[model samples]
Target: MQALRIAATGMDAQQKRVETVSNNIANMSTTAYDTRRAEFADLHYQQLRAPGAISSSTGLIAPAGIELGLGVRTSAISVNHTQGSLRQTGGDLDLAIEGRGWFEVTLPSGDPAYTRDGAFKKTGEGLIVNSEGYPLAGDITIPQDARSITINANGEVYAYFDGETEGQQVGALQTTIFVNEKGLEAMGGNMFRETQASGAPIPGEPGLDGRGAIRQGFLEESSVDVVAQIADLIEAQRGYELNSKVISAADQMLGSTTQLR
Candidate 1:
């Protein structure tokens, strides 16, 4: 009976791993996408000892110890916050981070969220916004007639107007850091929110206090590795099959005890 439960646990763990790998593949092209992975730990084992309650003539030594692991279970599916690669797109609004920091964005709920995606654009009102129309944090706006826009590694927004020899600073973009970025929970749409486990936010300018520097005309690429994921998938499949065999063997042994002749 307990053996069946043990095998069931192994099945569940392997199934979770499969789901994790699938998600990683789905977001392989997503900007700033961090990979998700499942963790497992073995369950407690049972030991059998003693053939009789009282044995005066025989030694009091208990029967040889036998470890019977119940099963394996998933411990956690943590988000990997490793940095992604930066790609040049030749777009003024496109931005990418060079270190550990997140660009703050306004959410639909009027709350602030963080993102690594820097595909930004200017609205009709000259408001700098992301693809979702969410305004960038710190309020950066450029003139409609601005000839060309440029940003510096220090997050200084510059605008070049017609007949202007040089660019002028229009706005400043700031970055936010966390003590435990992996603790942040992703709410989809390339957004992430703070959590207690993530600790408090530490705001700073680009290239200051270990904050990430800004890269104009670039985007961050997903950090998922396809080869590693496929290998992990195969490992989980084999593990699940082995557990199934254990369950079947236990069943056959139990069936042999019955005699219908």
Candidate 2:
């Protein structure tokens, strides 16, 4: 019965692992997506014999203890913060971070959200916004009459007007960094919100004070590795199968004992 329970827990854990791998595989093409890893911890143990106990007959101390582990449980799911490769889209509004930073955007509720996806778009009102129509935090707006827009690697935005050789400065973008990037909560839609674990957001100009430089006309790809995820899926499947076999074996043993009685 104990073995059956333990095997059941194993199966549950492997099922969770499979789910994690499947999610990573599903989001392989998502822009600025980071893979997540499942972490597990062994359950409490049942102590059979206490260590360093004085032996009753031999008058000697026992050096080792006997303990049986209950099972395992999921501890945490950690996000992989590894940088993804940048792909050039040639779109004027497309942007990407070359190193470590996030673009701040103002949500519809006026709350600030951070994102690594730089695929920005201009609204009909000339307001710069992300794919979800959330305006960029700095309120950077493009002039309707601008001939061309230029964004430098240093996060400087310039708009060139008609018959004007020189481009006029429009707005400077800022990058936000967190002390614990992994602690940030994923809000879906390629956005993240700061949490107590993530610490406060540190805003600064791109390419300064350890912030990543802005790359216009580019987008960051997902960090998921297809091959590795597939491998993990297979491993989890095997683990689930092994646990099922253990349960079957335990059931058969219990049946035999009952038959004997």
Residue lDDT tens for model 1, 89-128: 9999999999999999988788889998999998898998
Candidate 2: tens digits of C-alpha lDDT, residues 1-261: 899999999999999999999999999999999999999999999888778877578788888888898999999889998889999999889999999999999988889999998999999888999989999988999999998899999999999999999999999999999999999999999999999999999999999999889999999999999999999999999999999999999999999999994
Clashes of each: 0, 0
Best by TM-score: 2
lDDT of 2 at 94: 93
Model 1 compared with the native: what TM-score?
Answer: 0.89
lDDT agreement of model 2 with the native:
0.93
lDDT of predicted model 1: 0.89
User: Which residue pairs collide, candidate 2?
Assistant: none
